[model samples]
Target: WLAKITLVENQVLLKYFVISASLAGIIFLKGAEGRICKTFSAISRLSNY
Candidate 1:
């Protein structure tokens, strides 16, 4: 019974870690996308000149 409880706890911890990691990844990707969009806009403006 003790082992079963430990197993359940470990699963919960693993799920928490996975969710946090996914959120971090999404934030990082969004940051990178913003930078890329800014760069593209700058390049387009320069070409227009």
Candidate 2:
């Protein structure tokens, strides 16, 4: 069961990594200079703390 749980956790981590990468790509393509990008960056910064 530990192995199974580890596998599930890995899958979840991979999914989130993919989502983050996609969002980053979109933000980069959008130039990250837009208001929305700034807002997102601010939110991420807050979440970091």
Instruction: Please report the candidate that would top lDDT against the real structure.
Output: 1
What is candidate 1's lDDT per residue for 1-49, written digit by digit as tens? 7566787798998999999999999999999999999999999999999
Top model number, TM-score: 1
Residue 5 in model 2: shift from native, Å? 6.8
Clashing pairs in 1: none
TM-score of decoy 2: 0.53
* Model 1 alpha-carbon miss at residue 37, Å: 2.5
